[model samples]
Structures are given as C-alpha cells and as structure tokens.
Target: MPNQTTFTIKLETELKDAFTKIAETEHCSVSQVMRDLMQQYIERHEYKHFLEDKVTSARASIANGQSIPHQDAKAIFKTRREKV
Candidate 1:
C-alpha cells in the first residue's frame, strides 16, 4: 500500500456542489473521485514526459546515423507482414 496524505484546496461552492453530485451519481465518494482524477492527471503528465523522452532519443539516434531509412524500414515491415 502507498502512504496516504491529505490535500486541501479551495473552490467555488457551485463547482464543489456539481462535482459532488456527479460523484454521487457515479456511486463514488468525493474523496475517491478526487483521488481518481489526481491519478489520471499524473498518468497523463507522465505519459507526455515518456513521449518527449522517446522523441529525444529518436532524434539523437537519427543524428548519429543510427536509424534506417524510411523506405527501407517500410519495405522491411512489408516483408515481415507478408511472412506473417
């Protein structure tokens, strides 16, 4: 299990009321809904970082002449698909 901590925030009453109503309709507690939203936000940010890192690595590899030509890669994949 992960260590749990409390987070505090202030928002308009109307926003809070709307969010609480949605959570209730979904059969979730307000805390659980907030936690789920936080987790989704974290995952989205982390995935963006992951994509940036991959793009950086790919650019470096291309600059170093370590990548195959596009047409060659496409041909290789075509052959692979035919084999499969």
Candidate 2:
C-alpha cells in the first residue's frame, strides 16, 4: 500500500451518526466509507467534465457542418465489425 496521510475533518452530529450506521451495516470503518465516498465523488466530477468537453466539441463540429448521416454511421460500424 502507498503511504497514508492523516487530516482532521469535522462533520455534523447527524451526518456523523448516519455515516456510522452505514459503516456498521457495510462492515467497514467510518474512515473507509468516507474515503470510498470521496473517491467516487471525485471520479464522478471528473467524468462530468469529460462529458461536457465532448459535448462542447460535438456542438462545435455540428456548427461547422462536420457530421455524418445516421445511415453512414451504421455502415461505418458494420464495416469496422466485419474487418475485426
């Protein structure tokens, strides 16, 4: 395992109690639950930005008339599958 770092965090009583209950139900420590939740939150935010960039690029492409027809897309996929 990589080296671990420690930091102090404060949570509301109700939120702390809720996390404790979930940790108990999941057979894990509260710290583990918080760590997993934070990891998932970070990944989700990253993916959101990634998708936003893709959408922005696609919109620019459409505005510039750089697009393929639906049938053309289907034919391209069919040819790719056949090649594979």
Candidate 3:
C-alpha cells in the first residue's frame, strides 16, 4: 500500500458489525476483505465491457461490409497456428 490513500464509506451499524465479526473470524482486517471484493467486482465488469466493445466493433464491421469470409478466416487462423 505504498502511495496509499484513505477511503471512507457509510454503512449501517449492523452491517458494519457483521463485517467486523467476519473479518475477526477470518483473522483479517475488514479493509482486506473489502479490497478483495472490490478487485473481483472491477475485474468482472471490465471483462464484461471488453466483450461488449468487441461485439459492437464486429457489428459495425459487418454493417460496413468489412469482414473476411468464414472459410478464409479459418484458413488464416490455421496457417498462423501451424507457424507457432
């Protein structure tokens, strides 16, 4: 956590207590659990958005008639795979 900054969030007392209890049970700080959860959430959404962007670009390419034939694409892929 070099170059770390403090972050604050509001939560209900009960929820905070529950989180604290779980953190103690696991012998880790609440911050660690929250960081892990946040990291997972960020990764999941980023991957989802990346796929969405790819689909949109593919759709645009098709709309503009800028795509190779399926067979041609497959042959290119096979050739490249063999070269590896």
Candidate 4:
C-alpha cells in the first residue's frame, strides 16, 4: 500500500450522518467512500476536458479541409472490413 495521510474535512451534520450510513451499508469507512468519490470526480472532469479538446481538434480539421465526407468514410471502412 502507498503511504497514507490524515486530514480533516468539515461537513454539515446531516450530510455527515448520511455519508456515515452509506459507508456502513457499503461495509467501508467514510474515508474510503470520500476517496472513491473524489477519484471518480477527477476522472470524469479529466475526460470532459479530453473530449472538449478532441472536438476542438476535429472542428479545426474540418475547417482546414482535412476530413473526408461521412459517406466516403463509411465506404472506406466497409471495404476494409470486407477485405478481412
């Protein structure tokens, strides 16, 4: 296991109680639940930015006339699949 660190977080009493119940139901500590949720939030935020960049790149490619028509692309892919 990696080194662990302890920190304090302030939560509303209702939220804390609800999360404690959730942790108990899941058979894990509140810290584990918070860690998992934080990790998921980070991953999803990163993926959102990744997709935004890809969309921007694709728009630039289209503007620069570097993309094929959708029908042409479909035909190319179909031919390749048939050859296999």
Give the top-scoring candidate (TM-score). 1
Residue 32 lDDT in candidate 3: 95
* Number of clashing pairs per prediction, in order: 0, 0, 0, 0
Model 3 residue runs over 4 Å out of place are: 66-84
Model 1 scores worst on lDDT over the 10 consecutive residues at 1-10
Per-prediction TM-score, please? Answer: 0.91, 0.72, 0.68, 0.80
Q: What are the C-alpha RMSDs, in order, of all predicted structures?
A: 1.3, 3.0, 3.4, 2.1
lDDT of each: 0.96, 0.91, 0.96, 0.94
Question: Alpha carbon lDDT of residue 58, candidate 3?
Answer: 99
Model 3's lDDT to the true fold? 0.96
Tens digit per residue, CA lDDT, model 1, 11-57: 99999999999999999999999888999999999999999999999
Error of 3 at 18 (Å): 0.8
